[model samples]
Target: MMERPVRKHVRLKHYDYNQNGGYFITICTRGRIPLFREGDRLSAAGMIARACAEEISNHFPEIVVDLYCIMPDHVHFLFMAVGTPYMASVRSNPTISKVVQQYKAAVSRRIGRPVWQRSFYDHIIRNPTDLEETRRYIAQNPLKRMNSNG
Candidate 1:
């Protein structure tokens, strides 16, 4: 039998119209923590996580943020890209992934520890079906968290 070449899962390459640049990203802490404690206030870790997400948005001007939810352990975001998808040309440009790296690095500096996982979970939203499903997931993540907390 002949051996097949191993393939890398190049994100946008797998999708049809990589130019349709809307992404919903989910980022989580290295260890899932109800980092917020004591009062009903966000803990130091929680604040750091939020700052990371905000930095990602600030760094990636191409990404237009539509919505976001900053939780104790993870962050959710919905954003659209203004130009070609990050993969279209790799155009010697800083893409969403690089922005995320910057966010993670800054956060690690703030905490004096590695805070985030290396890679994030992202999905390209195409039509109404995908959009609605993603929105619903983002909307209900809080309820899911509350249930888990209880």
Candidate 2:
């Protein structure tokens, strides 16, 4: 019998994801299909995805979507968890995982199909430099993609 390859764990263990901090997240479309972009513009599905992502803040009051960019096959964003640890516990604040799950479901429902991969990639922003760099990266992602494709 052949053995399956082990999937690497992407999250930091023993860390509280609901804690107040900044996070950089990337969610890619299943199969890397270009479902979100049409030339230099976003497709209907992309627009839906972008809208759903923006609505995340409305649903999770403690989260603020700082910056985002919908790329051809992926979306990148930075969000800040502004709730304090005591408040998080008192209100049962949504974890980053939960937030991403809800965003994916919203996009899927609006587009009438599942568009995301199983899990998302996240980086906990540790400092001012990292935060600024991530913001720049998200803002420039579409341009980078366009340049690479041309």
Best by TM-score: 2
Q: Report the poorest 10 consecutive residues by lDDT, candidate 1.
A: 32-41
lDDT of each: 0.69, 0.90
Each model's TM-score? 0.71, 0.93
Q: lDDT value for candidate 1?
A: 0.69
- Give RMSD to native, each candidate: 5.6, 1.6
Query: Can you tell me which runs of candidate 1 are displaced by over 4 Å?
Result: 1-20, 36-40, 84-93
Candidate 2 per-residue lDDT over residues 39-126, each given as its tens digit: 8888999999989987998999999999988988999989899965755348755799999999999999999999889899999999
Q: Could you tell me how far off, in angstroms, the CA of residue 147 lies in candidate 2 after the best superposition?
A: 1.9
Look at candidate 1 and give me any clashing residue pairs. Answer: none
